[model samples]
Target chain A: MTTAIGQYQYDQVDRDFLAARIEEFSEQVARRLDGALTEDEFKPLRLMNGLYLQLHAYMLRVAVPYGTLNAAQVRAFADVARRYDRGYGHFTTRQNIQFNWIRLEDTPDILRLLADVDMHALQTSGNCIRNVTSDEFAGAAADELVDPRVHAEILRQWSTLHPEFTFLPRKFKIAISGSPNDRVAARFHDIGVIARPGDDGRVVFQIFVGGGLGRTPIVGQELYDSVPEERLLATLEAIIRVYNAHGRRDNIYKARIKILVQALGVAAYRNEVEAELAQMDIARYRLSPEMVASIEARFAAPDLQAPEGAAAVLAEQRAQNMVFDRWVRSNTHAHRSEGHIIAVVSLKPPGEIPGDVTADQLDRLAGLSERFAYGELRTTHLQNVVFGHVRQDQLYDLWRGLVDVGLGAPNVGLIGDIVACPGLDYCALANARSIPIAQKLGARFADMTLQEQIGALQINISGCINACGHHHAGHIGLLGVDKRGEEFFQMTLGGRADDQATVGKILGPALPEDDTVDAIARIVDRYLQERSGQESFLETLKRVGEAPFKEAAYDTV
Target chain B: MKRAVRVGAGEGLVITANRLLDGAIVWLSADHTWQTAIQRAEVLVSDAVSERLEGVQSRAQADGVVGIYEIAVRPEVGGPVPLTMRERIRAFGPTVHPQFAYEQQEGAGA
Candidate 1:
């Protein structure tokens, strides 16, 4: 192997394997294009790298877990945009980027380029393993028990082209949440891992399995109360092996782990995972302490010296700039450090499509990450960017920079803090456009005072029920449906975004386009009028039930 | 008069498919006059572009100013379709979802 950059580094064996795979695929594509290879022969090769041709031409989706990227990695994406794609990329609600147009010939080069930056399209698509996702605020969130990224990365390394598990019956998705606030939609993934402090004061994961949305949406079952940190990877391997051996391969839709879990029940599935775990050769497959240490060392945060006069600087900014202060209050979360705060950049502006960042905006965010946030950039599942370690002193400067770019809205946890997917407009799967509805809702609640009065509400919009926007997790969820070539929306209320999360209950009949925003306004207005001064939206909705909200939402002219 | 327009991102070109048709893909050129490569082409192909332009075209005729044919025009799928402001808005979906309750059910069924 080539000299290791560090322990647990990307060795020559890995690089050579990937390179050979790319060349083999390239040759396969060449043969197909030249009429030497049949579609059957080429299918497996394309499936290996997460490339797929749907009803339209080929679409290549690259998974970015919980939307975390360093400056260098962002630049690499920019390279992919400039080189392989048509100078732009579409970011999906799953924290992935889809390049809709791609020639089969150039895919190998794209893979090679991605390999250079320690990324690949491996298992991003197809009917086998998919990329693992975690909370975007994992390592940096003050409220997190531990960084879920470590576990996600570990899973990613283990699952990448594992011979035994590459050909599962259907696609599998795993999401982990480090934050107590369920930001990663853990309950909706095939496997959900939530990090928590165990009895021994060590961080362990509570594992859930089988939750998914498609033709049938079912909440996942809790498989483990707490799995020891050391045994996490082995336990995951066991789960996969069990699913691979028994999951239905006859009907493609019934092949997902969700069906397996449903068929076996949670108790049986747990028993199976345990049985498989007991049979595994732990000595051969387990991650050694040294390997774990090496990976952890690579992710160590830079030493940040506290800025002088940070509090006074923030105080002055807050006093002089109402907009900046509102942004800081709504969009910025407190950091563990005395002077640093995590500033979120909301992409959900009124009337704008969700997760639609322009190339110029991406470049600017990358530059800002380098300048004011110690070069760390994170994309939240709520469709926003987090400058993980921004100093309080730089708040005004950062706000000014964001304001110039039309991103300085302070509606983070308020009703305006909306999470939406690109609906019918861009997605072949969507029934309606979710962005415009989200935008209108955001603009309606644009007043900072009103937003603060509403307080800590999540409004999630999904074009369809695939729940890409995690509508189920929102306190107020909006789902789009198409009626006779016309768009309609359904409202669900009383959902939670925390540990005791529940899917929102649907209100009444769908409202008209012009009336929907006002309908939401009426709901919020009723909450404001009826709620006790300190009660949040979810709490108020729970106490009053759906009757009041339903009445308010539909009573509008 | 008939014209073709390159809509969305990629290689699939949309043709008027016949003379005197107006679809969202049709537009004025840089010179402030109607022009379309797809409408002007002698042949059209069944490809990604054709699939995208399927319903947005006029009926094909034996002899018309614009003709729609399906052929494999190009092998490579280009990037996102560069949409006009109007197209971008349409691409986003309806302004509200509740307005079309029946359509929502159909979408879910699909």
Candidate 2:
């Protein structure tokens, strides 16, 4: 028997809560359909429930909190895809699933189905605090200091229907990281929480504020060096309260906490938050050590099995099959448990839409999860699925299963593994089509050997300046713009979203869609020439200072 | 004629809106029926385009469509075509997913 840990356990109370929410939304949808409520009034209500009317049809975003999902939930998602949406669902950068072709009327039934599985789209959209994201390798990764899922769950519970701060100037995002490597882009969130070793060698939450992407992409500043465990929630509340009171309400563009923090400066912002904290009853928001321990206790331990001589057998298999060896190396992470590995199935196939999984694939992956990972899985912000507890011997079988289902592309962080938003294709707020750009690039670098040679490059593409695809965080970022009537793309270089989080700067003037892909290939060729030994693309760019790459891109174009 | 659009092309105006019940893209046809085809839209060729637009906007506010606006079209060989890329995309479909386009669909795929 396998134990389910770190995944939120929903009781009857939680089920009741979801049912009530669905009932309320169902009534509102009815009122809108019957002409009792105008579209203006119903827009916010539909948005709160994660329903959006796009260029073609309605889109529904379902929150997978901290990217956690069970086998049953995956199957349910497959059902949603087959029954409600098109044959596929798109996983977003925020670790949420977006069904692109939802009808406005079918949303009530979708919510009811989700509620049956102890899921709902509350706070997935709207001005309220959205779903809390974290490292996908939360509890299973060997390098993690603490599982950030515990804290992420806390944020999810506290922020849901938070009446006081629900209607803030703009939407709020929070991300947590317990790993030394910041995989979740925590630094780019409105509130970034890093579980760090304090002076006493105990875990203390390092608080960051004002970091965000979009029109004004700003890296957050460390608000507190070390906040004690009991004070995490209280400190966060104070910080949010400050933003709610003073954040710009007039201009939609100047409404994010980043703008307010930039305007007031970090020092002055801290003083306001500190003053607010001093006045408030800290005890009310205190997340006591005992409470945290209890919550941790609620999580069931993984009943991992040890297969005799599994590693030796796997080594034999790898020796026989070089292709499988490359896949094993690229697609798995170091696990916390002995003889166990974290197996990631790539959702990105060469020349296909990034983060899209078909209904058939979802159902099959659910079965695969049950066989290898104790029926538990994770969705990464990079748009991949993780089987958190696979034994060494089971990996080969799992790999074969994935290949059969077409989820076995071994390029997780390579150039082929791109991040792109639904730009002009489905989104109403887009200037150009992002998927075609990704498709052209992915096709160019389709060869596995070529991608491996390119070595850990992220190419993010956004349809607009909104940065939903996180163009600011890519090693090679492409922002799509509409010049006159045609599509043009702006290129950026030397950006990364790891521990050393930094934004990419524009390399050269914008190029047409036809020329942009070719220009990027030229830049990659320039990097191959500029690099010394096994230095990364970022290292090469940082050393050469965008001069060679800039020349390589624009000169040819 | 005087709205949030770039002035271009030849002929006239056509009222387009997302039908309230299902959010389907609909165009005001020659008989003032809200049909799903842009080709069937009534093209107003007269100088009283502003008055016609106002009447449509008011009627749109009170009825079956929510986001209602007029599209500037050029009378092409096939039918009246939207001037801007935005309207053209709206008229045709999303470039990436051609299957989801209104024109390409077999009765809008249920």
Best-matching candidate per TM-score: 2
* Predicted candidate 1 versus true structure: per-residue lDDT over A1-557, tens digit per residue: 22211112455777787788778877876776665655566666776776765212255777675566766556667777777664556566666776644656677788788777655677887666677777766666688777777667777777777788878888888888777777777877788899887888766888888887655666778888788878888888888899999999999778889999999999999899888877788777766667766776656465666777897889998999887887887888777677778898887666555566656666777778778877767776676778878888987888888877777767777787788876654455777778788778877887778788789888988878777777767788888876754678887887664567576777877766678888888988898898987998888877888888888998855
lDDT of 2 by residue, A89-190 (tens): 999989999998888889999989887777788788878899999999998999998888877888888898898978999999999989878888878889
Model 2 C-alpha lDDT per residue in residues B1-110, reported as the tens digit of each score = 44454445466778778876667778877665677878777887555556766776677645567787776788877777887666787788866666766673223311
Residue A73 of model 1 has an lDDT of 58
**Reference-based lDDT, each prediction:** 0.67, 0.85
Model 1 segments more than 4 A misplaced? A1-18, A37-47, A52-58, A82-88, A100-109, A197-202, A511-515, B1-110
- Candidate no. 1 TM-score: 0.79
Every candidate's chain B TM-score = 0.24, 0.76
* Docking quality class, candidate 2: medium
For candidate 1, give the lDDT of residue A298: 52
Candidate 2 is scored at a TM of 0.96
Worst 10 residues of 2 chain B by lDDT: B101-110
Give residue A82's lDDT in candidate 2 (0 to 100).
Answer: 98
